[model samples]
Structures are given as structure tokens and as C-alpha cells.
Target: MTSKLTTGRAGIRRGAAAIATAGLAAASLVAVVPTPPASAGVGKAGASPQVPQSPPLPQSTQYSADGWKARPEQYDGMDIERDVPITMKDGVKLLADIQRPTRHGKVVPGRFPVLVQQTPYIKTVLSLPPINWALVKRGYVIVTVDVRGTGGSGGKWPVWGEPEHSDGKSVVEWAASHNRPWSDGRVGLFGISYGGINQLFTASQRPKGLKAIAPAVPMGDLYRDLVGKGGRGYLELAPAYLAAVSGLGILPNTNLLKDPATALKNIQEHWDAAAGNLKMIPEMIQGGDRAYDSAWYRERSPLTYVDRIQVPTLLMGGEFDAFQRGTPMLYQRLSAKGTPVQFINGPWSHAIAAIPAAGVSLPGVINEPPGVKLGELQLRWFDHYVRGVPDPALDRRNKQVTYFENGANQWRTARQWPPADVRYQKAYLSGQASKGRPGALGTPVSGTPDTVKWNLFSGLCSRSTFQWLLFGGEFGNGPQKIPCMTDNRYNDQSGLTYDLPVRGRPLRFTGPVNAHFTVSTKSRDSQLTVRLEDVGPDGSAIQLTAGWLSLSMRELERGRSVVRNGMVVQPWHPYTKASQKPMPKNKPVTVDVEIFPASWSVQPGHHLRLAVQTGDFPHLFPPFPQLKDSFGGDVKLWHDKTHPSWITLPTQPS
Candidate 1:
């Protein structure tokens, strides 16, 4: 905290400084205490080591706690150094909390590899996941730095902008320098969500001394993966994001005056400034603007500059993670360029990405099953790169993709994404959902056409009971919001359901799902939503993945699309304003929608269902207010030979 650093925002009050210091040390739920583990000494070199049990964590924040505690901290003799100041190249000073191995209330004498995590979330509060203790005990120095504008740092918080990136490089270089205690000048990056995204962009700069990064459930593109999807903004989620960041008060004007009483006057000033910035966030994200691929959005997206990353990386997440789309694309781009990288997708959600393989549930509210833990794998990765410990298993695992297949509830390794053995199959759509018989999915049986209609007022938001993972807890207790796996019969009644008859044998599916349709509507523009569901024998429906496309943004760049095994894996679409076209009355138009990727197993006798609807409400604002009521009475769909409408599944052999 002593380093002389410039305050980039407004001047800070020195006495007001004590406010942040007190906040960091207060007994609020967010306070982080780096409690040492059971004193278990290490065995001989290469000897079987005893697993260090994680210290008891607060139950309220168990998700974040368990996330940190999921992995055993092998090293028990560790100590924390709080509020260390780090100077950025621009002369702005950031704050960091370091955890290092210690003995007899003193630092252990040794140069160890460093792992840096830059977070807007308070570094001292959220830094020590249970895994960091284990890492420190195993001879690593873990530095959790508060990004500019947040924590107790001296600067205007710029969020994920250039200031944060520049500060990140400076922090890494400083940690790698010889002056820091216990650091060997080698650094690796790690974090989840916001923490994870910072790592990706920071590593893209390829700062001196940065050796590797392991980002879990990171948003590859801010516009596409974070604020919106398929060119549409997440109306409800965007405001929620703003509220959470504002609640943190992480970015206050830090320009401090020397006098204590004078400094207190600036507290209100800081509050006002923070509030103003929060107000601007919605506009900054273009939350209400119906524009895609804008220069403002592109500048905030890592997708545009990801090619600059040169460090080895481990992209990790759950199959159902909110940030799922971006990671796979990043993995593919990096792998194709021969940058050392690996991807691990599991059956968990964004909150529990780091939960241990043996899941723990707390009472009736929190029900969790065994999940993939990255602690051990991370240790191995850093050990090899930072400590010179060669691991053949890491090498082999990286040669292909490693993911946990849901339904099967087991981990599977594949040579390529979608797996090399995947067989993409198409199921044609037919019949009427409103009819008692509903619709059937099968081979073209007579090439007959069918139609179903829903008024804009009739559509219900099909969010299911699943709480968004990002909104859930951070570490240990895991997300209190488990995806609602309950029967969706009631929900299916709200949309058009096309069910496949009972399967003769178990059908396992992996990777992305595609839905192609030929439809016509009287409205000038509309939104067509498609959802994948698993129908059990009892008639209960398990919702799977869903896809959405604003009718106007349906123009696809087919030639630029990615095709695998003659099937479109990722269809490139020009969602820009220029490519937008209106739908003419009764004029059939072909459209392709890419559903979210998934790994699910349909048991024998169970069925698969494709639910199509005009729109989903609340979750997304129904088109623009001006176009909300433009359903134009009725919508029509065709399945004749001339217009074969079908849903494609990426299937794996039984």
C-alpha cells in the first residue's frame, strides 16, 4: 500500500482511505481470511503426499468457498501478505494480496513460481479459493491483485478496458521481478468469469514473465457471449450485471487529499462518480441498442484480438456454462494456430466449474453431484511449465479434447471437438403441436406440410427453473441455482413441440445442434426460437439447449461457415444492420439457427423433442417495443419436399 502510484480518477481522501482498509478487514460476508490448513508436512521427494484438508469456510458463501476448497492444498505452512502495492507502467498503483509458504510465523526462504490473478472482484476477499492454499503449500506464490479502480487500489476503475490490461502486464512483470519475496520470475494466470476474462486479454499482450493461463468459463467475446447472443441483447441479464457491479463499489474516485477531514468531503464525491459510471454501463454495453458488430462492441471483444495470445492455456468450463460458446471457439482458433492449448468441458455449470469430482450437497436447497475439478490438473500444468516437472498425462490429454459427457455422467476424451466419431443426423418436422397428436420427428414421411400459430401475447419466457450460473454463488456451496431439471410438460404446452418416438436404444449426443426451417409470417420482422428437449416415457419433458435469431439477422454467410462431416458446425451470419431483411407476407424463407452445444444421453424408450415458438418473453424483451405486436395474426411453416424443414443432431455411436 506504500508504493507511490498515481490516482487516475478524481483525487482521493486520505482518511477516506481508512474506509476501504476497514472494508477489506471488516467481518462482512465478503471478507476473506487466509486461514492456514492442518499442519501436514511433506513426505520425501516423489513420495506419496498426504492431502491437506481445506479449512472450514462460511456456509453463506460456500459456493465461492467450495470452489476454492474443492482442491486440497498440499502445503499447510502458508502465510498471507495483505495490501501490497504494485506500480503499473502508467504510474498507477494497484493493490495485491500474496499468499506464500511460511513457517514459525515467518516467510519460508525460497524462490517459487508465481500465479497471478487480476480481479475487479476484491482481490483480498475473493482471491484465496481453497486451491490457493494447496498451491502455496506445494511451493508456489499466489498473488491476487485488485485491478485498477477496484479493491483498495488507487485509480479510476476502467473495467475490462485498456487500463486494466496495461495494469495486468505491469503487475505480472513486477511479481516476476527479483525484488519480490519468494518469486522465481515465472508467472501463470488463473481465475473464473471476470477473473478468467482478464487473464485471456492480459495474456494476449504476452507480457514478460507470464508463462501460462488457465481460464474457466471465460467470455471470449464480450458482445456475443456476455451481453447478447445471436445479435440480440439479454435484456434481463444485462441490468442484473450492472446492478452487481454497482453493488461492489469497486471503482470509486481514488484521488486522495492529504488531510483526513478534507478527505471525508470527497467520499460523497466518490459515491456520485461511481453512480454515474454505473449509469453509463448499460449504454456502454449497448444493452438497449439493437445493433450488432458495432465498433464499440468489437473493441470490447477478445475474439477480435485473441490471435495475439502466445502463452500455453487451459480453457475450462461446463457444457452448460453461460460462457460455453466462446471457449470452444477460442480453443479451436488457438489449436489451429498450434498454440499450446487444451479444453475441458464438464457436466457442471459456470458456478461449479471448479467443484471437486466428488460433489457435496448442503441440505434440501443445494443438490450437487460429482463434478470435474481443475485443481489437480492446474497443479500439474503449472508444475510442468513453472517447476519443470514433465507430465505425460497432460501431454496426452492436450492432444485431444477432454470433456465430461452429461447423461452418461462420465468423462470422455476426444481427438477433435464434436469428436471424430460423431454422426450428424437430421430429423424432419411434421404435424401440428396444437393437435392432440402433437408433431412427429422422423424421416420425410410423405413430405407433407404443417403449421402452428402463436400470438405475440401468448408466448411465455421458457427460462425453466434453472437460475443463471453467473448469478449463482462463486465457489464452494456452488450455484444455488441448479438448472431446473423438472418436467417441462407445462412449458412445452406453451410452445410448438415436435417429439421423436421412443428410441430403440440409448442415443448419446455431443456438440452443437442445428435447426433449419422454411417459414412465412405476415409480420415485417419476428424472432424464431427453437429448443431441444428430452422426453421421458412418463411424458415428462427435460429441456435441453435453445437457439434464437432475430428474423432480420437470418442472412447467413454460408461460404464463411464452418462445416464438419458435411454438416454445418458453426454457420457464419452477417448480423449487421445492412444484412437485415424484412419478412414478406406469406413468402417462405429458409433460415438456419445454431442451437447451443450439448452432451446428452437419451435412454432407450425415451424420446427427443424440438420445440419451436415465435418468441420467449421476459428473458428477452419481445423484439423492439415498436415491433412487439407485429406477429401479424398467424405464422406458417412448411415441410414439403420442396421445403424440407428439419432439426439436425450431432449424435455419437451407441
Candidate 2:
């Protein structure tokens, strides 16, 4: 069964509003404190796109962050200082909006710690800045800068290049310096998506007075996390993301009428920058350094510089986020270095995490333990780190990590991620499976290999659509509201599945997953996706984690690939042009697919299934050359004695 979405006025509006849209991240729109909201001036260009408002949370769902509560709002409102210019080292003046606590029409006396957010999206049109005025009212000065080449800021956008990194550090220093009278000389960085990702780059620079950082739903490895889903460009979402930021960057600056010359220059620079980025998409479609994990990708990936970030960090990720594969990687590196860090992995997607549902619940999908409001959690992080205020609750929080384990349906905290007791286990796929029916997992039988067709539209209404679309792609049809996106049954029916029945206690698995397969295809090339899902007795398939691999780029970075007790738990592929090679048609080749990490407890009656399919474009997001190269073919998965296939899973001893 193929997936389809009914597009209409309501659906289209919902889709557009839900995109990260550069300016849409950062504001916590939860049940806010009862006060006249601190108002900030909207940019002459326009206000940020508004999302549908979620209703108030039920009292039972309200969460307290380990007994941590927000500091009292000492001010009635906040006053905005718009179009404030901050000159960078290269003489480019980036425009910023400063929001300071105010009463009546006067600025409050004395200084407050500065909180900085650098956005590629226009700073002035940022969505609902006033909604965050409550944060300013709590004794903090908030500043949001339009990253170079966007908004009123000068200089060309290098697309997350050295210039942006340098600018990030320069901006942090500017906010933390005494040059700004309102600044208390201490700084913390926060934002979502673009705003959030830059914090890592800036903090890695180790600017003075930088205290802490909390990057919500940010990506560490750009190429692997956002650009390249497996070994190809993630066109399913990357194109839209690139187009949005670039297109919005070149828009006319409404606040620049007073300075026509500067405004024209800004537009010209942005147009050129956006053009240069868009040009690379075509190059990427054809195989080149742009398509591979070359220096271009490595230089911009925040993970490359994570070792240098010394500040206390709070990283938030969704189990279903685009960056799910890399958030834990960053967390692990930070923890290994003994850097103060906390990680929260929710069952949310990027959009849900950015503008959460009322009470942390996503309607009928899953209800989260409404923990401390998201904004409050960020406040706590900033207060403890930037403000230097001692909080016993924070000390307790610093020692633990939080995660929402689905299926178990509760907030679970551990001293470390994946819990130390988790052991790597393997479930082998059986060779004896009938045509058009699912096969059994474990205790392999010597029989014929299974086959699957190369079908690009296989993953349409699955979790991948919801995940890749960055919103609720699960809502099928206009007003008909079929819950097909969340259910993997539609996808599984079209793929090859191997299941392992669960008995006695619930078969729980937590942490990274891998699918090691030995296969051959009718064509010289093929791209395949592996999905680890929970199959209920009612025949419902809930995708837990997924991985992708193109046969051409199957060479592993031996040293980087993770192995435990001789089993490859996490396989790392370089995805470089040099590593990419055409496959030998109809020849058996082994592949190790790196599935994203997740913590889920499959209830007793629910069996675990590993699924594989190819031509899933909406999720695979492969570039044109790769997609075209592996366009159509019949692929075979061998599970006979000599060519056994299996999945490596992290499970705890019962």
C-alpha cells in the first residue's frame, strides 16, 4: 500500500506553519506566567510565522523539573531596542534586537546576565519574541542577532562556514563584554534548530564569560544528521530546509528604508549567498565532493569541534528527531571528557519539541509527564550557570540524565544514558520465509533468499514522513484524519519483515540499533532502509529506529565503527567519494546499517520486527545521482547458514 496526503487549505496551512522556518524556533509557548507579556518591536519585514496555540495543560500533566521552579518575574514587562548594530571582527555590523525588563516606559536599573541567540533567520521578525519577554522579566537581558547575510546584518552567509563560527564567537564576546551597559558580563546561549546549532559552534570557541548553553533540537553532525540520512543527501527535507533559510535570507529588509544603500547591499549579498548554496544541490545530485562526506561537510559539522566546548551543556533531542543519531554521540563525547552535561531525549519530533503540545502530550499518540515547562527548564540551566546562583535541585539534576521511554510510558532518569546494564544482543534472521509473508527471527534455517523491489514511494505515510516532514505527516487526508502516519503497518506491509515473538516479561531494548545484512541486487547499485519496529498482537507496527545504506558506499571506517564482543553494534561509514564504489550485480555483499538510538520497552505480547526496503525517497533523501544510479532493481536478502543476516540490539538482562 502506498502512502498519500490530502492537501487542502487547512492541511497546507498546517504544513507551512509547522516548518522550523528559521525564525520559528526558541520561544516557549507553554502556559506562561500570568502577566502582561513583555513586548518587543516586530521587524519592518514582518512578524515570525505564528503556530496554532495549544491549550492549557491538565494539572496532573504539569511537570516540575526535579523540584526546580522558575525565579519570580521581578518586572512587569520588557522594552525592545530594535536594529541595534554590533560590529564583528571583520567590520560587518550584524543587527540585533535587545529586550530588557521595563516598568511603565523606563528601562530597569542595574545589569543582568546576557542571553544570546544567533539566528540565520531575521532577528527582528522572530516568532513571538514577546512570549519570551517573561524570561527577560526574570532578571535577564535577551539578545537575538541576525546572522551575517540575513536580515539587516552585513557580510555573505558562508553557509555554516568559518565566517559564521567566527561571528558566533564575536557575538558572544560582544554580549558578554562591558561595552553593553545592560550586560552583567556573563553569557549563556540558547535557541532551537538554527539558533540552537550555532551555540555549539560558538561555545566551542571558548569565548570569555561564556557560562552555559542549551541547544534544543539541534544537530551535531550536519552531514550525517540532516544532510545525508545514510550515505546520500536527505532531499526529503534538506531541500526544503535549504530553500527556506536561503529564500528568507534574501527578502527585503523593511527596517532598512532609512539606509537604502545598506539595505541594497544586504540584499545583494544574501542573494549571492543563497544562489551559491542552491547551486550546490544540483552538484550534490551528481556525485562530487558535495555529495560525499568531504571536508566541506566535516568543517561545518558541530561534532568536529565538540571536544573544545568547555561550558556546562544541556542538550535536548527527540527520539524521532532528525538528529536522533547524533545527539547521543555528542552527549557521549561530552560525558567522556567530564564536561558538565545533561541530556533529555523525548518521544517528540523536531516541530513538537520546538512548539510543544499542551501538557507535553501529542494528542492520541503519547502523553508526556508534563515536566517543568520547556522554557522554565532552559531558565534553570541559565540561572545556575550564567547567573551563578546556587540551586540544590540543579546539583541533583547535573548528576542524572532524563529520557521518555515509549511503550513503558514514563519519564526515566539514569546516572548515564542507555543505562550501564544494557547489553548488546543479536537476533538473526531466518532463511525459510514464504513469499509475501513475514519471516521468523532467530535460529536461522537454510532456505531460499527473500526478495524486495526497488520502490521509491514505500515510506510515504510512515513515521519517517512525520519525522522528515518535521511535522505531523501522520495526519492523512483533509479532515478525514486517518492516523496512518504513526502506524507502520502501511509501510511494513510493503517491506520484508523478520519477527521475533516475545514471551514472559516485556522484551525491552534501549540504545543504538544495527542491521547487518548479506545481500545482492539485480542491478549494480541499490539503496535500502532498515526499520526496527514493535509488532503488536493486533498487527500494529510501531517503528522504533531506522537506518539506511547504499551498497556503493559500504566501506566502513574500521577504526570508527563500533564493535562490542566481536559484534558490530554501530557501524560508521565514511561516505566519501573515494569510498563509494559500484556494486557487483547479483553478488553477495555484507552491509552493516547504523540505526539511530532509542529507549523503548516492548510490552509482553508485542513481538520485535526488523524490516528492510528500498526506494524510500521521502525518508532516504538520496541525491539525484545516487537515486538515479540505483533507480530500479530486485534485491535479495540471504539468510542461509553461510550468509546469515541479523540485527544488533541493546537489551537489558531480564
> Best by lDDT, which number?
2
Clashes (backbone N, CA, C under 3 Å), per candidate, total: 24, 4
lDDT, candidate 1, at 613: 66
Candidate 1 lDDT over 345-432, as tens digits, reads 8765555563321111213222233433344557767776766555565566564677776666677778677788888888888765
lDDT of 2 at 404: 86
Candidate 1's TM-score? 0.80
Global lDDT of each model? 0.60, 0.71
Which 10-residue window in model 1 sums to the lowest lDDT?
35-44
Number of colliding residue pairs in model 1:
24
Error of 1 at 43 (Å): 36
Error of 1 at 364 (Å): 14
Candidate 2, 1-654: lDDT as tens digits = 111122233543454444433224423210010101112221122232333221221222223445556656666656666666677777887777777766655667666788877777666555233335546767777787888777777888777788888878777776766545566668888777676677888889998778998877777787888777678677776766777778877787755776789888888888888898888777777766688888898888889999999999988888987778877888888888888998888887765666431112124443344654654677778778887767776776663667887888877777776678789987888854534578888766776888877877788777777777665433335211546667787787677888888888887777888888899986767888888889899998888888888888888876898788988888999988888888888999998888889888888898888888885656665666666677776678898889988888899765
Candidate 1: regions farther than 4 A off: 1-75, 128-131, 250-291, 356-373, 435-437, 446-485, 565-567, 622-634
List TM-score per model, in order: 0.80, 0.88
